[model samples]
Every structure is written in structure tokens, then in C-alpha cells.
Target chain A: MAIFRWGMHFDPLAHLRQIQRELDRVSWPWTAGARRIGGGTYPPVNVYESDAEVVVQCEVAGVEPSDLDVSITGETLTVKGIKKPLPREEELNFIRRERGSGEFTRTVVLPNEVDAEKVEANLRDGVMTIRLPKKAAGKPTRVEIKG
Target chain B: MAQDKSVKVKTTVSAAEAAEDAFSPLVDIYEKDDGLVLVADVPGASKGDISVQVDKGVLTLAAEARFDVPGEAYSRTYLSFEPGRFFRAFALSDEIDRDRITATVSKGVLTVELPKAEAARSRKIEIKVLE
Candidate 1:
């Protein structure tokens, strides 16, 4: 939906934001099963939130650092990368294959506004962890009522 | 549950604590002309923490998932994964060279290589022509 008005620019990530909200309402691959739903969604993710920051963990086994791309755009954090396969010898015959390798784009809409300047990401043991600190306005505040 | 305990019975139990008291990690099995390879996805486990064993013609993969993050979650929003043990097993064929089997962990994925036995591998017999 587009609203033509002053200072009301068309939001491109609005649909992604809506999907993120729906994913939160129900159990995901972790609760269900770790099956590859699609080509791009191979690496499943889990999110954690605290008062200060939001930590995002992505399962990226067999993915290298050189193949990863992490960026924050407005209310969404996107991860683009490729999962590379191992080298195989000649005349190799496969009997069973369950793993997959391909390029993927995973975007998560953050619940709170984050400080992009302070965001940091690290990859280890086939898992990537990203920490995004919440902005002052995004942090929760306790309001006091006086009699 | 059937207590068949047979090798053909793919007791692929899901959810928790069926294989040696741990969650069964998903695996990919493929075969080559020489042998076979098993790839398992076990994130959050270090190289030293993961273990692979081939005993009694059965292969097993085990890893300890770690939580490096600190602080309790203020509110659970999208909690999908956690730190725990991953366990899975498979029955191997007799053609495999169990003595030469090896395993390694990289980027939290465990790869196990099982070479075929000498007698089991197919060899190209050279045809001798008598003139």
C-alpha cells in the first residue's frame, strides 16, 4: 500500500516487517523441525532481547566469513550469504544427499529501533551472532504517576 | 514403540533424548566410489567439543551446543534455538573399513569419512590378449 502525502515515503521493507511479526506469533523451524523450507532459508535463526541489546544467532555451518554479508536497513536486519560445499574427488558417486548449498537472503525485522553505529557481528563454530543496541527512544521506560 | 533393535529399523526419533540422551542432529549421507561420507549439522559446538565414533558397525555423532551470550531475556520474542547436546546414530554396512574411518569438525559441521574395505571395492580386471 502506498500513501501519497508529504513526508510519507513508501516503505519498502514494510512487508518484511509484517512477516517478522507473524513469525513471532508461532513456533518456527526450531520448534517444528530443521528442514530446509526453501533454498534461501537454510540457515535458521534465533533471537534474544535484553534491555540494552538484541542478539541474533544464525546457524551457518559450512559457511565461511568471506561469504557472509550483514547490514541493517531501518527496522530490518538482512543477512546475505552463500553456503559453500566441500571439495570432492573425481568419479564421486552419491547415494544419499540431504545437505544443501546456495545463496540466501535472510531478513529479520527488529522490534525496537537499534543504534546502527554500535551494531557488531561475529561468526564462530558455524554460528553468527549479531548484537544491536537499542536506541534511547526504543528502550523501555517506567512511567511514575504521582497522586 | 517397537523394541526391534535391528539395524534396518531407522529409529529416527525426533524432539529430545532418544539417542544417548541428546537431540538428534540432522545429517547428510553421501557415497563415493571409494567409500562414504556423513555430514552433520551441529551448531554452537567447538571443534574439541564434538565427537564422532564408529563402533560395532554403527556410527554416532555427538556435540554440545554452547550459549556464549549473557543476560536473561527481558521478554521472549523469537526464541527458536537453545544450547543443548546433539546426538544421532546410523548403522554402517560391512563393506566399510571401520579401522580407517576418520572425522573432523569445521564451522560447527562434523564430517566423517568411511573408506570401503579392500575386498569390497570393485577393481577393474585387466584383460590379457593372447596373440
Candidate 2:
């Protein structure tokens, strides 16, 4: 039995990647520059914001916790890590090698000001989730309307 | 010669079975003295979300990510792809000990160890003088 199915025949994930590639090409006319920029960003990330905080999740499989470094400055969050390749025997032959391993650094700008001191991060099952608490002053205040 | 022919046939059959909607997870296969180890990058797949099965000399991996965020995404800068399910299969030959195969999932990576059958494993042979 097929465990997972999304709609009749829609693959949003693949389509999204295609669109992202096209956008990259348009922004960077130089194909070589685009390729170099793309290769460095090893893991893809998703950012979401709620009323109280902004959360970022990054896919970083095969990366050891010791090799990961996360830092925040002003409204920017930076994640850096190194993914080491698995050990192989001399006689071992690889039929397919799709996963790339190396050092990667990704920095994202937050939509709102956050309290960097209160930021929290956790790495589980190859996904790193970082939560940045929005500063109290940064939240929108509602004024009372006189009737 | 017969084994080689069968292997070629299996490869073609699997190639034809690839589907459009299914995304193949990036994988690295390594051969060791005991067996072959396949490491697959399946980010967002937790422990209970992944399944490994062997049917008719074929090994298949299916994984789905559990991502249910309450709020809408505000921005997407560098998303290689949206998080979703992934499927990949490999045609295992008769040399593999299907029963002894083992799998483990950790930090979004799946490692499958397919041990070679007794007859397929390498064994040093000793020769003595005929005298």
C-alpha cells in the first residue's frame, strides 16, 4: 500500500524547486555565479512567524551536532555546519552518489525584531528548528477607539 | 553470464516504473566486507514516518515528513524543495541476505545494511601440497 499521497497528481515540492531555480537564474544572469551560490547553500530552510515569535527550520541530515554553529545578530540568524561523508572501504563502489557533503552557511533576515537572548534551537531527526521570540516592543499595539 | 543478464533486466524494469509525482531521496550506497550499506537523506522524516520493505528481491524506502505549522509562511529564501513524502526503490540481487537486512533512522538519515548471503561472502581458501 502507498503510505503517502497528495491529491491526484500534484507535486508541489518539485514544482517549487523548479520555480526557485528559475528565479535564481533571472536574478543572477551569470550562470556560473548562480551555480556557485546554489552549491554553497547545502540545506534548504523554511521560515514562519507567529504573533509571539519567528521560527526557522532547516534540513541538515548527516550533519553532526558538534559541527553545527548557530548565531544571531540584530535581525539576522546564521546557521553554519559541516556534513562529513561516510567512511567507505577501498573496494567499495558507489552506483549512485546524489547527496553532497561539505561545509555550508545560511543566513536569513527576520521579518521583525526579536530578542536574541531568548532564542532557542533544537536538532532532531536531521531537522534543526530555531525559535526567535519577538520583542515585546516590536509587537503591534492596539489603541482603544473612542465610541 | 546468466546472473549479469538478470541484473540488467531488473534495472530496466525499475527504471520504467519510476513515477512523475514521487521524489527520489538522495542516497549513497557503499559496499563493505559483510554487505552493502545504503544511506539516504530524508530530512523531516521522523522515526515512525519511515518504512523499509523488501518484496521480490527489491528494497523500497518510503518516508513522509510531519510538518503542520499553525501560521502561514512569511518568506521562503532558499528552499531546495518543499517538505513532503519521498519514495525510492532498489533491485536487490540474490547475493543479499534479505532476512538479515537491518535499518535505522537518525537525524533524518536512513541507513540500511544489506548483509551478503553466506555463499556470496568472500572466504579465504587455503591450499596444501599434494605430497
Candidate 3:
């Protein structure tokens, strides 16, 4: 089927500019920022590493450890999980939806080459941890004197 | 804009609070000699365990910050931490050297150094005219 090309289509650049403006309108936090939780809850996820492995830890309160899925292949590591939003009835008075829900995929590239065969992942206390072993080079290097 | 196909039970809060909470992490873009330096505020993120990824022209970052406060004593009255997965994505242009992009997180702050292509970096040239 032939597609219709109308010259009056909205400009993409203008739309992008509008999106930028809207993004700017968003209220931003500073170096130290946090939010208030109505009920008992934890904080945002934090990721870090150690001498032995490149570790990733996420604070997924109210979420079971079994719900998380982590995969690592070569330099790419993916963490896809779900956070079931808190349930409430009796029509919300009216406000905003800040928390992101449903499925989430977080992929990171390993800083150094890693051994895909020995990668390990663990989850406990609503925190998911992924450990990747660094690839080891065989044997130490030796130098010979030349005349 | 409100079209509801079904009624579902969910948490309902004020719009203003939600708006303020949504974009909690503020990202700063710095243009340096290397390329673009992105410093993002991931409050709970630690230097040892932050994830930075670049695919095609898209960049994604996620981290987890542990307070280490034992048990219920750390009851949050006003938790600035969103207490969930933090995600951010940026569509990069040719200005970024994807292969050379280096990222490091220190003290809950993430620093990403996007190196510029060799040709894109500014360099001083000597103009010598020979007869």
C-alpha cells in the first residue's frame, strides 16, 4: 500500500524541544536527596564492587528475591526484575505516580574482561547481587636479555 | 486524556508529591577535554557496586545504596530515597567515544567520562611555511 506523505506533519525538532522543556520543568534534587514513604519501606538500590568481583546490589523492598533475573554474557550484564506496586483501594484523592512499576531491565558493561562461565548471582533481603569473575591471563611473563 | 477500560486497585497519592519524587536523581552533564562527563546523584549507590552500560547510542545506569542502619531504628520519617530501582537513559550522538567511555562511582556519586574521538579533540597545530 502506498503511504501518504503530508508536508504539514509536525516538526520532530520542535517536538523534541518541547520534550526538553517539559523535562526542565521537573523538580530536581540536589547532591543529597530522598523522599518520604507513607508506610514502612526501604531506600533506593545501590550498586558497588569489591576486590574479588564486580558486584551489583539493588534495594528491592517489598519484592521477593525469586522475582529477579540476572544474566551476564561477555561484557554485557543484564538485570531484569519487577516491583509490584503497593496496592490500595478507595479511589486515590488525586496525585502523581512517581514510582516506576512493571518489568525493568538494567544492563551494564563490565569494566574488565570477565569469565562468563563462572559468573554468579545472589539475592537476599530485597537486594540482588551479581558477581563476575575477572578473566585471568595464563602464566607470569618472563623477559630474556638480548645482546 | 483519561480513558479507563477497567478499574484496578492501586496506591493513590497526591500528584505534587509524585511529581517531585519521580525525577529524584539529578544528572549533571559536564563537557570536558575527554568528551562529556555525566555526574549523577545516586544517593544509596556505592563506589564498589554501580552499573553503567552503553548499547548502540543508549546509555543506562542502575545502582544500589545500602544505609547499613540495623533494623527498625532507621525508621524513615521523610525518606528522600525512592526505595526502588533507579534508571536513567541517554541517547548519545557521534560526540561520544563508546569504546573508550569510562565510568567510576565514588561515595554514592557516579562519574562517567565519555572520551571524545581523537579527531574531535582540540589540538594545537604548528603552521610552518616553506619556500
Alpha carbon lDDT of each predicted model = 0.71, 0.71, 0.52
Off by over 4 Å in 3: A1-147, B1-24, B69-76, B128-131
lDDT assessment of candidate 1: 0.71
For residue B101, model 2's alpha carbon misses the true position, in angstroms, by 1.0
TM-score of chain A, all candidates: 0.64, 0.64, 0.52
lDDT of 1 by residue, B1-131 (tens): 53321112112323333343355676677787789888877788876676666666777676788857546654445544667788766788999987787777777778778899999998999999999
Candidate number achieving the greatest DockQ relative to the actual structure = 1
Native-to-model Cα distance after best TM-score fit, residue B1 in candidate 1, in Å: 49
Interface RMSD of each: 6.8, 9.3, 19.4
Tens-place lDDT digits, model 3, residues A35-104: 3332222233333443445544455533445667777766666676775533431333212234334566
Worst 10 residues of 2 chain A by lDDT: A1-10
Worst 10 residues of 1 chain B by lDDT: B4-13
Sorted into a CAPRI-style docking class, model 2 comes out as acceptable
Sort by TM-score, top down from the best? 1, 2, 3
Error of 1 at A141 (Å): 16
User: Which 10-residue span in candidate 3 chain A carries the lowest summed lDDT?
Assistant: A1-10
TM-scores of the candidates are: 0.72, 0.70, 0.37
lDDT string for model 2 (A1-147, tens) is 113311133455878878877887787654412122123356777677767888788888878899999998877788989998776434568766778777888878776788989998888768888889888874577899999
Clashing pairs in 1: none
